[model samples]
Target: MIRTTGLTKRYGRVTAVDGVDLHVPPGVRFGLLGPNGSGKTTLVRMLLGLVHPTAGSVELLGAAMPRHAASVLPRVGALVENPASWAHLSGRANLRLLDAAGSGGRRRDRRRRVEEALERVGLGGVDRRPVRAYSLGMRQRLGIAAALLRSPELLLLDEPTNGLDPRGIGEMRELLTALNAAGTTVVLSSHLLTEVEALCTRVGVMDAGRLVLTEDLAALRTPTGLVVLRTRDPARAVDVLGRAVVARSGDTVTVRADDPAALNAHLVSSGVAVAELAAQRRSLEQVVLELTGPGADRVDPGRADRAGPPHQGDAVPVRGGVR
Candidate 1:
């Protein structure tokens, strides 16, 4: 339940976010996908009133932002960038402190919320342990628990799976899925396309401070579907399938045609022997790169120098980490 129109943000002469429009429906996990310095964090901050936009408008839960942010934000929970916690406190204690400060619930209610959050994030048994003793995944879960302290209606998570191992990532995915299924609106900003593909029904891709494309994940799929045809003579296959392009290994030819079956029939009739014919589904990463242009993998040289060389630990901040 969020909408932005011509949303623009600038820093002096540089426009970090430019004229982006976004619409998110209720109870959906929408993904904001972009590389570093693509204005994803800037947009999220503007939505939260953490940063004021130079132009355009933002509405959250049907109310204009900043003017109504105070009332609306209480219903919104966010974990921006990397997870943050008081290193000395236990996981449960960290959430308890937040609950005491802003959650407005009683002791028993707060405790139940903490435990449920921990359980949802797969950290139930370990909530008694100090945060400093927890691993990166645990800390991430704790951050999520803190966000859920008040049973927020909207969750804004940035790079939620940044440092997790495979299992931890899967758990995070499952948790988000369940949250959305239970009617929580989730806006997840991430550079990991595969994770977004699995979690989000809709995706927005940003580049050079502007939203280049927003589409349902299903709409991004090829109209004809993808086909990978293998033949004894790769050269002949390419010649036979005029519209096809040879994939990375050269032996595999990828084709996007509206009628793959007809193409197969034509190839067979043309005496082109096909050793293998399989559908090649486009991954979210491939579709995003295609829509955002070929240089999607290229990082901003300026942000790279400013953020410093990447470390082994999490580089993203707990909130608005990209700044």
Candidate 2:
């Protein structure tokens, strides 16, 4: 569980995170979504006490952050931006060192903990090669493994599937689902809309450093009072539906109907053989695209020259254009 109120972080004249009030309850997979430099990473850092807020407060697992980070952070696992380890050391050696440095567990059990963590991240069979020799995906798995060393109750991950291949991404999804099923709270920040749609129960959207929207994924994707059906008799179906028909292409017909079942029954009764039918629902991509503006990484000198200087919360234009 995590909570923040009026959380604001500023770097001189620019605000990275502004007036954010976030609430993440236990037993839910929460996804944080935003474009690059939308203050997502900054907010994550503030939650973990890695970045101090210029104004407002942060609470992690019922305790104030930084103030109680020592007592609370040990029970939480995190991977921020990228994972780092001594390149010359073997994967096993690196994990052992991390476990030894962290709190909890007896010294004798450190090896078992490290091995278990590695296994959870699909690195159980890794050889004695130094971390520098590991592929990008391998290093990513290693970072996740290190986060699991403490058997944390809460996992706060940023770009969790960054370097993973399709198979590795699938494995990470399964691992996170299993962890959540076992009572660990999971929160992830990612640019992958489909990944978040598949893995998260709740979502929070950030734009221009503000928490623009937060809602249950199911609610956001609710039926749009329209039914799309594929039929052999598109012409006849269109005739029967009349004004209700909104779109048509080949065998598919989109009709403005509140109930797919009712629409299907009527179509069948009228001799329209329906092949497939379902209610129209919004995709996560649509939801996020509608809520957020262009990312901070995007800069157009011509647009800036035309529009003049940016307003308070607009993406600051780079003088020389995007690098």
Q: Write the per-residue lDDT of candidate 1 for residues 55-109, one digit (tens) a residue.
A: 9999999999879966887788888767777788898888777777765667898
Q: Model 2: clashing residue pairs?
A: none
Candidate 1 stretches with Cα past 4 Å from truth are: 224-226, 230-257, 261-276, 291-323
Residue 124's C-alpha lDDT in candidate 1?
78
lDDT of 1: 0.77
Tens-place lDDT per residue, model 2, 56-146, is 9999999998799878988988887777788899889988887777754786799899889889999999999999999988988988888
Best by lDDT: 2
How well does candidate 2 match the true structure in TM-score terms? 0.92
The lowest-lDDT stretch of 10 consecutive residues in candidate 2 is: 314-323
Q: Tell me each candidate's TM-score.
A: 0.80, 0.92
Per-residue lDDT of 139 in model 2: 86
